[model samples]
Target chain A: MHPRRWTEFAIESLIRVLGLSSIGFVLLIFLFLLKEGLPAFLQVPPENLLGTRWYPTFDLFGTLPLILGSLLVTATAISIALPLGVATAVFVREVAPGWAREVLKPMIEVLAGIPSVVLGFFGMTVLAPLVRETLDAPTGLTAFTGGLVLAYMALPTIISVAEDALDAVPKSYRDAGLAMGATQWQTIWRVVVPAARSGILTAVMLGMGRAIGETMAVMMVTGNAARMPTTIDSLFRPVRTMTATIAAEMGEVARGSTHYHVLFGIGIILFVITFVLNLVAAGAIFKKRRRGGLR
Target chain B: MRPKIRVDHLSFYYGDKQALFDISMEIRERQITALIGPSGCGKSTFLRCLNRMNDTIPGTRLEGRVLLDGQDVYAPGTDVVDLRRRVGMVFQRPNPFPQSIFDNVAFGPRVLGLCRGRDELEEVVERSLRDVRLWDEVKDNLKQDALSLSLGQQQRLCIARVIAVQPEVILMDEPCSALDPIVTLGIEELMKRLREQYTIVIVTHNMQQAARVSDWTGFFWLGRLVEMGPTGDVFTRPQQKLTEDYITGRAG
Candidate 1:
């Protein structure tokens, strides 16, 4: 028996153990969420979750407002972030030259690396004031401010994802377009952008998922009123999202109470929204691969 | 007509490194001129110089005249777009856009605005695809993805794309390097057919290919034009010691 073969065996066993440990951790998180979330649903009746009003204090937790609020905030954030984020990504990857690329890349990295609390504070101080001043409102914290902050926070993800997507298109594609006598701008618009469509979709969906899952930054900005929004303009008003509801009420609501259980239910809603968004991202990636398949 | 191209004491520099020397050549109208040399002997660089494709690379400077039909291609007033449109190029790798087979053939015609109506455009595309002998195989599958084609088919598609534009001159940079022997022969035959209408210049490492396909052969050595003449003269008779050793397989 050679010592080299023993070394190979050891390395192989280590890789297997490491892979299983990762899977075990993901399984643990899924099981924990399922176990804690399932019982609360069983204890709380369907009318409590789906009925007209939302009042969970008397062993009846209606989840309508929280669900609506979460949808509103996530959709608003995505609407604002997508265009600006993708444009910045294109500028950084294509239009920006050497010194600009060097400067912009690290700045985006720092934006991504900043602590969420610090971002929340910045949102609290800067963005909220801007929104308040523009809207002529008393409260700086509103859904608009929260959405702005989340867009700012998710900017790095969108830019990096879209940049990687644009970069993955081979240089030959660009060269082919150029050699066809197409202008630079025309080539970028017609050939490069269309080729990167699925990739850009994935980036947008990933950013959407991230914005929806965001907690601290969004919580610090949105006014957290928990009212059912009437008009689209009211999106800028104080609104308590599901995550915000959980954060604001989970501690005060005692254990086994309907309010506490409903907060847990809000967690389930947030998890579901994020899960759907991620599934959309995965589907876009699959479609891109299918279209760009090896023949 | 005028000579299709003229190179006089043409030299090129890649950064501080010089790639082409005081090499001069002329491409007459409707002729297939083959450039042959060992690897890294500036043959490809000289071929690229014709269409100013080398302008894409930064820090590359050229001091020469690349006159297409006596019009200076290096002249500042010369529009690169118009020049490239008139002088199409095909790469060694057969790079077709990730598009439908029809779109790939239609790309150049669309860019040049060669046809106004859809029927005329389709007719041109069909004719171009037929010219390279790929229309019969791909006519039914025009809507299929270009990437779905095999390597040999893709190379032919690229050739079809160049002809679709109806360019006066075509530059082929080792077009058959990535294909099998049968495909290479097919392309060689296609080149024979294409030479009647388009002036073709190609770089090939295969000496036999140059001998078989080209009327004129230019031998490059260490960035210098060692010798150039009719393919028969270069292959049968020795003009220079280097050309003799190289063609005879004795020395590079």
Candidate 2:
């Protein structure tokens, strides 16, 4: 074989290996998680594992409160972020003048690049006290405070993705709407936004994925109480998340103990949730492409 | 017949470059007026000028007057939305909102608040679809996504969407350019039928289409009107040398 052919073969093999290695790594992580975490599910009684308490020293290990805490904080974050992000995206994409759009887009991208730890620090210092005073809650660090921080962290993702979706709508749709006597607002709401619905929904799902997987900001502000958030008022009360529990206890946990395995169990659960969210987001994007291609 | 729209020394500029030179013409009420020209000869730009659609583009400037029903549409404080409602437009390609067929047609009436209630809105949608002769074909599938329709049907739906607002004039900019010959014939036939109620101004690259459908035809060359007259005379006995050359395939 020629030397050129040998070099080509080497490059192709190297590329294939690099591509396959990511899948290999993901599978290895899943297998490792299952091997360590599966024992907790089997050894611990189902009632104990699924109970309300998460007292590790006393071997309680119920993940119900942690799971609920994560859901409450993430749901609050999304509820706050979705509307604000989508509105900002519309303003930037459809309403802003060219120079303003050029300036605003880069600023939003810069916002997304801010470290999550810094946001967490800000939440710990500024947002928690504000929430505590505003709501007159007993403590500042609560699910609501955590949600506010997460919402800010997730805003840039939602805005940029939704803006791209709105931008992808064909220019002809706007012309048609305007030609029919619709005002700019009417055209955007009735035609352009509706046309980009699936893409916008995908953006929301991806933002939710980012918010749910986030650890640092949530852990800092959510006053790790490990209590069930059963009442509506629990939104303003201290709660611990699955992620915070794993992060906080992993350092002192005895190796291969059931408590350590339970933490791994929480990791598996988080991975599954974000994986499903990304799948749904992908599905929405696929649907948008199919509809877009039809014309 | 009185002119529904009158253009007096109209000129348009996009930023530093002028697009349309001083061009003047009359669009008679309930008549089909076609502008035939080569690509980039300013026919579409002139058509957009009638309804002030050019205002949507950034850094574009228009001088001279476009009067609709003897009212200057470009005058200060002229309600652009109202002017566009009076004069609707169809584009080169069919552009339906990514929605159901019913919603696509009803969009205009809903936005303009022309209908009193759901029943009236439904009546308007049905009437508009019938006007475009698309009711029978799409009535069974009004709930289906508009994108699911064939290109010809989508174009017809776009026409339905425009007429649902009940405009006094319809401006078509190469409305059939994206269509097949058969589909183009269908649209042309619709334009003729539409002329009974609304004044129509069409810009077409196909001289044969202008000859077939328009009562009054204007020939544009290089941003200027070379000739304007009855379609028969313009096609058969064009007075200007440029018009004659263009009609005889001698020069663009």
| Number of the top-ranking candidate, with lDDT as the measure | 2
Return the DockQ of model 1.
0.44
Retained true contacts (fraction), each candidate: 0.38, 0.82
Candidate 2 wrong stretches, greater than 4 Å: A291-295
| Docking category of candidate 2 | medium
Q: C-alpha displacement of A123 in model 1, angstroms?
A: 2.3
Fnat value of model 1: 0.38
lDDT of 2 at A92: 99
Q: What is the TM-score of each candidate against the true structure?
A: 0.89, 0.98
Clashes of each: 0, 0
Lowest summed lDDT over 10 consecutive residues: which window, candidate 1 chain B?
Answer: B49-58
**Clashing residue pairs found in predicted model 1:** none
Encode model 2's per-residue lDDT on A1-295: one tens digit a residue.
Answer: 9999999999999999999999999899889999988888887898998899989999999999999999999999999999999999999999999999999999998999999999999999999999989988888999999999999998999999999989988999999999999999999999888888877887899789888888888899999999999987999999898889999999999999999898998888888888888887787778767766323
Q: How much is the lDDT of residue B113 in candidate 2?
A: 92
Q: Candidate 2, what DockQ? A: 0.76
